[model samples]
Structure formats: structure tokens, C-alpha cells
Target: MPAFSVMGEFEVIQRYFANSGRARKDTLIGVGDDGAVLQLREGYDLVVTTDTMVAGTHFFPDVDPRALGHKLVAVNISDLAAMGAEPAWLSLAMTLPKVEDPWLAAFADAFSETADYYDCQLVGGDTTRGPMTFTVVAKGQVPHGKMLTRRGAKVGDFIYVTGTLGDAGLGLRLCQGQVEVSKKHSAHILQRFHYPTARLAIGQALRTVASSAMDLSDGLYSDIQHLMHRSAVGASLDIERLPLSQALKDSCDRSTALALALSGGEDYELLFTVPESKKSMLDVLLSPYGVPVTCIGRITGAAGKLELRAGNEPFAYEHRGFEHFEK
Candidate 1:
């Protein structure tokens, strides 16, 4: 008999995940429930998002379970951050081929700790035996009618992104053995890939100033299209203005770094636009977040089209971002 079979599903949940994370007052009924009963704060809009990760597809089969757990929470929390929401509740559904006690313990510890770091409570989840996969449903709250979205970008809004890009992409390449890096930089790159941070504070601050916003899950090349499409606007991306880390710059040539920044995906950074009127106060407003912001482009009047430029001259590239069902 398999080791996992020794413990029934209910027992596994109680042992590993039932008491994970904080106990939020808003969660009237949490684990051990047919359904979680949650209370929404008055005058707030409920923001919900879901993400899933498959072992072989999303991560290496032998990757650290602790890092995987943190990544799972960070990615889902990033969506809530993009919407300028305060993360409140999380429900996870885990499918595993087999449960190893040590792996489960490490993963649960990291998951619970990460959830608490973000002030989120794990309300409920399901466990089952199957292929290695994990799914999380994150719930957040934003002030009524003040949530930032990708639909309000105006024709002259300046496109901005939080934090440096392309590091996570390089990190992915390093993990796949596609690139070699100095020992000094390898650890930083690997951590960026394994442990991503959700811009929760910056996102909430953006609600008042940003005309439009979304998190970078797919590469910027692909994600910008979605924002532009939703807002019914076009964009002009300045290749020169993209932010790259010193490590990324040292690891590869300018062009390779640019390509990664453009379409490598999984950065989990915030991509947003601010109207011209808000430009002056933007820096002052976002100073508290302590994360760097870069102006990469501006919204254009040309609907359904994206123009790329390197300072003054026109630039062209055709790299698509990560997508599941592309032929």
C-alpha cells in the first residue's frame, strides 16, 4: 500500500492544512466546513481571483516544496494586489500523487507563513490523490467603486511598471540550465523565481492615481495587449525605459535581457498606467511603497495597435508572452 493511502483524506487535511495560517475575525467559519462562511466589510467590493500550478508543468518535479508553496500564494495574491484589494481569505485545493510527510510539512509551513505575512487567513481547501497540482482561490476587498482595473486607461496615460523585470525570466532559464551565471548572482536570480512578492501596498495606493492596472503574469509583451484591449486603447512602449536589474544586465547582453523583459512571463510585477494629471503626484504618492517604478510607455490614440520605439527610432519585435492554448 502507498504511504498516502495509510492516511485518509480527512486526516491528511487535519494534520497538514486545517490549522494553517492566521485566524481572521472576518472568517466566521473556517476549516472543517462544507463551505467557509466569510463576512465582508461594509462598503467594500469583493475581489476574487484563482490560480493553479501543476508540478511538471509549472515547476520542476524535484523543486523545493517550501518554495513552491510560497510561489503558489504569491502568484494568487499578486492578482488581488493588481486590483488594489486587501487580501482577506484563501481557499486551496490540492491534488497530489502521493503525500510524503516531510514534503507536506515543509510545504504547509511555508504556505501558512506566507499567508500570514500577507495578513490572509486560509479559510478552507480540499485534498485529494491525483497528479501533482495545487490551486488557490484568493479573496480580497476594495473600497466600493474605487477598485483599479485595466479598463480605464486614457489616451495619454503614462504606462508604468513596478520593480525590475526580466530577473524572474533569467531565473527560469537558469533553472532549466539554459543559461550560466556567476555564483554571486545565481542565488538572487533563483530566489526571484522561487519566491515572488505581491505588491499589495503599492496596489492599494494605485487605486486613486492609476487609470488602469494589472499584474504581469504573462510576459509584458502579452500582458500589455490585454490591458490595451480592455481599455480600447493603444500603446507606445519605449524599449530604452525598461528597468533591468544589475544581475540581469551582467548575466546577458542588452538584447537578450530585453527579450526576457518583454515576454518571459511570471514576473508577478504590477503594470499600470497613470493619467497625465496624476503624473506630478505619482512619485510622491508611491514613495511609501519602497519599490521602484518605471515609465515604460504611454497610452496611444491608435486603437488596437502597439508601437514600439527605442528612444527616437521605431523598434520592432515579435515575441509572444506565455499563453496556454497557442497553436
Candidate 2:
């Protein structure tokens, strides 16, 4: 049997989360207070985002505590990155079945490490006994009038995405025993699922160049559709131009790989549009960042029309992206 903590909520917070090391200079009041106080930078706009990860819904119950902690913070930061903002501070609200010291220690360590890596400080949070879930509220900053959004794509803009897609969805399948891959390729795909790297640098680089942008959390098909809806434009994606990783290509057949790339979620890559005139500069500007940016489509004048074409022929795909309430 696992040992449970007898400490009260305040003691738990003090023991695990109230460390001064997690506090940033901008944080006037961190953990243990009723609320956190932070000083925002001058001439910058604040971007706040929150994401929840629930046991069974968002992750397996037996998942590593460290990876879960990392993901809990990462997904929230990805939203800030989508807006070309620099992550500044975060608050966590965690609901655990019970308090186990060793488990809490591992989770807190990993969580702090990830926050520190992004230069984000933990300001305030709450802990409670309930189903296992985590809600992270993250705040970031962008220069005044330069925050990216999903409402600026134009008819002649070029659509591009950073990094390859579908590996995480494949990784999920491998974890669930629905598919199999060679031992050599399993680790790469699995890591892609469990440890997604937010495209922060790419987002920061495209602040001035991208007309509209969003992080790919709900797969390219659904996410780009959202961007189109927001921008009031249409698009035509070339099926052959979609990027795929070697592990994905080798693990599945061409059609299956393409399907995953189209509708697979949780890749956490950035999808943005640049004006046709700036196309030449896009690659050159992002080349120094070392993240692959591939132009997959073009915005069109036909509003609400999104088509996937394969060399001038219209292609059909039945599966849409993940929906929270699908029957």
C-alpha cells in the first residue's frame, strides 16, 4: 500500500510548492499567499491561457509523474506561444486522489524544472483531494500591437507549419497496443507523444511576419479550419506537401501515415500564414532557428472552403480531428 501524507493543505503547499527557488523577481507574492502579485512589463500586452489535463481523458493513469508534470505545464505554455508571447508566470491547480510524498516530490521537481527552463515562474496555486487532474494558468507577454492571432490571413497568404505531424497520434496507438513499430523507432515516437516541445522560438520569430497563427493542438485539419473560420478565408492544402517524420512513414503505410498527419492531434506545432510577398523571406528568417517550416497550402478567396488536393485532384478523408463530445 502507498503511504499517504497526514499534512494539511497549507503544510502540503509549504512542503512541496512554496520554495523560494521557484519564485521570480517579478513575483512579489508567490505560493502560500491568497493570491499572487506580478509586475507586467511596460509597453507589452499580457496573454493568459489555461489548460486542463484529467486522468484517463488526457493521460493514462499509470503515466510517469515526471512526464505528466512536464505536460501539465507545456500544454498551457503552448497557447502563449501561439500568440507570439514570451512566457512569464504560471499558476497550478491540482486535484489528486491522495497525497503520496514520493509522487508529489517527483511531480513538483519536474514541474519546477520545466517552468524554469522556459523562464516562467510559479506564482500561486491550489491543491485538493479528488480525481487526478491538473489545471495550469499561464501568463505571457508580447509587444504592444504585435500579438499574433487567428484573424489575419488573407486570400493570397501562404500557409505553413513548423515541424512534422502525426508522430504523437502514432505514439498513442503504439502505447495502447493498437499498432506496432520496430523497437528502434518506438522511443522517438513515444517521446513525441509524451514530451511535446512547444514552438516558442518559431512563434517569437514569426511575430512580425505571420499574418495569422495558432498552435496545432487539434491536428492540422481541424486547427487550420479554425484559423480559416477566424480569418474569414478559405484554403487548399496539397496532400503531397504535408510533412512526415521518418518514424511515422516507416511505421505505417502511406495512406495511414497521411491520415494521421491530417487529423492527429497534440503535435503542438505552429501553423501560420505569411503574405505571398514575404514567402521568400519566411524560410530565410526561420532557417537560423533550425525548425523546419513547410508551406503546405495557400489561402483562397472562397470563404469557408477547405480542400485537400493531390496534384490537382481532390482527395477525400473521412476522419475529422479530435472532438471533446463526439457520440
The Cα local distance difference test for each model comes to 0.90, 0.86
Q: Which candidate number maximizes TM-score?
A: 1
lDDT of 2: 0.86
172: Cα error in model 1, Å: 0.5
TM-score of each predicted structure versus truth: 0.96, 0.95
Poorest lDDT segment (10 consecutive residues) of candidate 1: 318-327
Best by the lDDT measure:
1
C-alpha-based local distance difference test score of model 1: 0.90
lDDT of 2 by residue, 198-298 (tens): 88988988987999999988789888889999999999999899999999999999998988898878889999999988888887889898989999999
lDDT of 1 by residue, 181-276 (tens): 899999999988899999999999998999999999888988999999999999999999999999999999988999989988889999999999
Stretches > 4 Å off in candidate 2: 1-6, 20-22, 322-327
